[model samples]
Target: MAGDAEGFTDFATSCSGRLFRTAWLLTGDWHLAEDLVQETLGKVYRAWTKRSRPDDPAAYARTTLVRTFVSHRRRRGSAERPTDSVPDTPGGETDVALRVTLLGALGRLDAKDRAVLVLRYWEDRSVEETAAELGLSAGAVRSRSFRALDRLRAVLGTDADDPTRSGVAR
Candidate 1:
């Protein structure tokens, strides 16, 4: 129906930016993040057309995006390979450097660990909500979140001596 299409379009327009941010965090590449958002929107659109509308379209889209990222990582023969040197960028700000460092550390984490951290910390979702999103138990989500933070801290080399040094705010 025309009304349904308009509704879906409006929803997509409003949520695309947030979805792209989550996708970018999940995938450390801009192009890949765009593709991921497109794929997620396609999935959501299909579901929207075929079934009754979901109670929470935003949450549905977020779950789909995260699941899609994890599923892609599970697949074999991914074409992406890390390059020895990054392409030159103009910014030299300290905040930019710290953000890049944090993203690099996140990229090094396992997909599930990255998902847990992004959902729990970056998105500021509760443990129960994260558990529901990631299809993990509450205890598992808590455990993974704790361990992932430790791994991230190790990667970022942020010790107790200088908590303020890490760009992440309390």
Candidate 2:
């Protein structure tokens, strides 16, 4: 029991930042991202205390986080509430603008599409890995990734042939 607690403590400390980043990308809200991470960590801890620990705790945590985000979106009352004003985020002008624009466009995506894009592009996961994590087939991952990119382009109003125009590098 003591060993499990110590191991989980170390694991959570090391991976929390990465988990928070993925959560933020998935949810596009700072507070919600924090809550998602907390919930994910709780689930991971519960699993850690079980008789059989996951072969890859980090991957398990990441999968748990993504699944939690997707399921939360499916809940009826989990819809986003609009704020009258945007909170200020500190960053350089161009970087901040591009980040905000991209996040906005991503936020407009369906939950599964957003999950596909984030896992495939932002996290740089392979199609097979993403499919496994999302419980989707490789073909479904590929199809969703392609269509999600198109949807992102449409939302950003950028030419499909010139993704750089949206300030995203290839």
Candidate 3:
């Protein structure tokens, strides 16, 4: 019992930051990302306590986070509340602007598309791994990756050359 607790603690300590980043990409809101990570940890912990630890706990956690984000977005109350003004954050002005631009562009994507982009590009997962994680086939993952990149390029108004010139601060 004690060993399981210690192992879980170690796992959480090692994996939480990456999981948090994934959550942030999924939700496009820091607060919601925090909530998603906590929910994922709880679910994983429960499964761990039951001695049903997955062969790859990190992958399991990622899968759980993505699924949870999708389910939450489907809720009626998940409609984002509009705010009149942007909240300020302590950062270099250009950095903040770039992050906001990127997140806004990501938010425009459907949940699955966003997930595929994050898993493939951000997390650097292979097509087969991403397909398994998202319950998709490799062909589907490849197709979605192609379509999602195109949509993101369109949303950001980037052409084939110098794609980063989307008015998003480097």
Candidate 4:
């Protein structure tokens, strides 16, 4: 029991940063992202305590995080605070304007659409894998992925002349 608890702690410590980043992308608010990560960790801990460990714990945790974000979005008060501009992080590798624009566009999407985009593009998941995680058919996942990309492109003001300018891959 002690060893299991220790292992879970180590797992959480190692994975928390990545989980928090995903949550931030999903929620588009730092505070809500923190809360979401904590909630996900708690859920994972409980599942760890109750059942045998999953073969791929990272995948299981990511599924839990996505499901939790979708569930949170369903609540009446799930609307996020709006920000006019992203704060400049000194020496950050990513472009702040692009990141903010992308996140703002993602925040506008419905929960399922956002989930599909995050799971498919951000997480680099396969269509079948994303479908299995979201409980959707493969065809549904593919369709949703295309629609989500279109919506994002519309929000980001993309066009044939500069489709790749948004930094979204084809």
Residue pairs with colliding backbones in model 2 are: none
Higher-scoring candidate on lDDT, 3 or 4 = 4
Give the lDDT of residue 38 in candidate 3: 97
Candidate topping lDDT: 2
lDDT of each: 0.80, 0.83, 0.77, 0.79
Residue 117, model 4: Cα distance from true site in angstroms: 1.1
Residue 114 of model 2, lDDT score:
94
Q: Against the hidden reference, what TM-scores do the models get?
A: 0.84, 0.87, 0.81, 0.86
How many steric overlaps are in each model, in order? 0, 0, 0, 0
Alpha-carbon deviation at 126 in model 3, angstroms: 0.9
Better of 2 and 3 by TM-score: 2
Summarize candidate 1's per-residue lDDT along 1-170 as a digit string, tens digits: 42389889999999999999899878787777899999999999988886576788899999999999999888736676533233333566556655666777878888999999888777889889898889999999989988888888888774531542345433
Tens digits of lDDT, candidate 4, 1-170:
42389889999999999898888777777888899999989988887776566777788888889898889888737455456554444476566666667777877789899989887777778999898888899999999888888888787773432633345553
**Model 3: residue 24 alpha-carbon error in angstroms:** 1.0
* Top model number, TM-score: 2
**Model with the higher TM-score, candidate 2 or 4:** 2
Off by over 4 Å in 1: 1-3, 76-94, 158-166
